[model samples]
Target: MHRRASPGSQDHFDLFPYIAILMSLLGALLTATLGMASLSLGPGVAETWDMAARDGTASKAPVLVEWDGSALTVHEGAQRRRVPWLDDQAAAAGGMRPRSAAMQRLLAEFGQRSATGYVLFAVRPSGFATLPRLTDDFRAAHIDIGYEPVGQERGVQLLSAGEHP
Candidate 1:
């Protein structure tokens, strides 16, 4: 026979098991959240890189320069100076000589570093059509250079030797 409770009596139930299950679920979610947070991707995760020499000689730090369709902006650490675009007259010269004074001086400066360093051009989309011409001009002027395509408005930061990021 089963005993029945009186109408005035109260029945209490334990909630500890349910509470424990919820707590464990919360712990698992928190752990997953933290695990996902630690995994980073893209440019943000690209912090440091050790540059290797191309020719088995001592690797020279690259000179960072931005190329839009109009001009080349050289990045020397925190400093930046724009190298004016080739003028119509220089273009007409068939790469023999630059008519612009600024272009002449910049070329002269880069000419001396051909063997010691290389120019890394961050070419913008607008500069794509003129990239070959720009590279040709630099080559004609005896400047060693390589290029990488980048977004139009993106800014590039160059890391120095023995530096990170």
Candidate 2:
């Protein structure tokens, strides 16, 4: 003779399997919730860049300028100096003429070496019309030309690279 499970015992036996399945589902839900929470608060791209630069692998350079910011500071680097002539002043000094042969030779040497990136020019508003032709000549010789127009009030007008007219 064999003994069978009582009704109460059978109910308990069936409940154990359902309880195990519920516990597994709850664990999965908890894991997904924690993952999403962690993802919502993380560092961004700029922070990473700051950290990398601070660690000392890369360096940055300062921007170029004609004059140093402080009045006391004098810039002594290589630069182009302009000589302008007004109508009466130019007439008094005599009409415009070609650059001296020695100066032309020096310019040719400078152009060949490519030591300078640009030749800064200062011209009057009335001389603006001649700039396009000057730019063309520089372009043909593989030299970049830049200019700043000085106004009556001594304002600066920057001419962009490759800009004409």
Candidate 3:
């Protein structure tokens, strides 16, 4: 025959299970409070470099270029150079395009050489026109593309492909 515990003994045994349940509830409550606090206290997210604009104007950012020079050099506090094809086009056609294959190749080489932040391309309006395709191509090759306008002209829109003004 089973014998029931005395009242004092039963009370003592019940205290442990009550304490365990209390502790579990407290732990769960603490975890949920911490999670909510974190959600409310985190800093705002930063915008992508390509989406950055300043003072109602598109700012010029640094870009890496591969020139004919022997050693890597940082010009104007950042490395930038004119490719051979760009030079040839400037000489022959009196104008150069920044979105050409040569420029892309230079950008690729620069990206491979540096461990710095994203590469910025100082492009003209014409160059900006080709940016969407270039960005796509770069992404396909696993490269990130960021761009900025170079000249002082205002009211120019640098839209990616399929972007509406």
Candidate 4:
């Protein structure tokens, strides 16, 4: 009988095929992971809202305001002003709370632009508790408004018709 090679004597374990298979699998996995990653990044980082009316009709641009639970930050073009809220006892004393000077200014501005613009509220979750009161105040002042809730940690980007990124 032909002498067989002694076990573990001069027998080279060829790892090339196994290494090639592993590399191929790794490459495929990496490609799949990258493809999935790209699909997950929808739009930009911030949430965007169209500046147009909800009905998708041509309408006036609104004055943007951010409402957290306790205060309002009115945005007029590039300028911003914070309007403070009344204390709980003061706000709950009567059926309606009194408006601050800043709040009145916003109302007056919206009032004047009622035909061309409306107040757009970017409300945070915290603001939901007192949102009814805020809306009531706007109604009392006869200011037209549209509101949309925003995520607490997300920034908002308002895109106008001619301006979209």
The 10-residue segment of model 2 with minimum total lDDT is 67-76
| Backbone clashes (count) for model 1 | 0
lDDT of candidate 3 at residue 109, scale 0 to 100: 68
Q: lDDT of each model, Cα atoms only?
A: 0.77, 0.43, 0.48, 0.79
List, residue by residue over 1-165, the lDDT tens digit for candidate 3: 999888767543348888999999999999999999888755542222233453545333334321222211123332344443333445477675434556557557656744543454545544555456555655665555565554423222233223443
Tens digit of per-residue lDDT, candidate 2, span 7-68: 77754335888899999999999999999877874332111101123345433311112221
Q: Which ten residues in a row have the lowest lDDT in candidate 3?
A: 65-74
lDDT of 4: 0.79
How far off is residue 115 in model 1, in Å?
1.7
- TM-scores across all candidates? 0.61, 0.31, 0.31, 0.64
Per residue, candidate 1 scores C-alpha lDDT tens digits across 1-165 of 999988769787899999999999999999998777777543344322235554557655578888998888998878899877766675786775443677678778888887788888888999999889888878998888888887776667766655665
Better of 1 and 4 by TM-score: 4
Once superposed on the true structure, which residue ranges of model 2 sit more than 4 Å away at CA? 1-99, 113-116, 152-165
Q: Which stretches of model 1 miss by more than 4 angstroms?
A: 1-57, 88-99
Two-way TM-score contest, 2 vs 3, winner: 3
RMSDs, each prediction?
8.1, 18.4, 16.2, 6.9
lDDT tens readout by residue for model 4, 2-80: 9998877886789999999999999999999999988886545567777765577766777778899788887765677
Candidate 2 pairs with clashing backbones:
none
What's the alpha carbon RMSD for model 1?
8.1
**Candidate 1 TM-score over all chains jointly:** 0.61
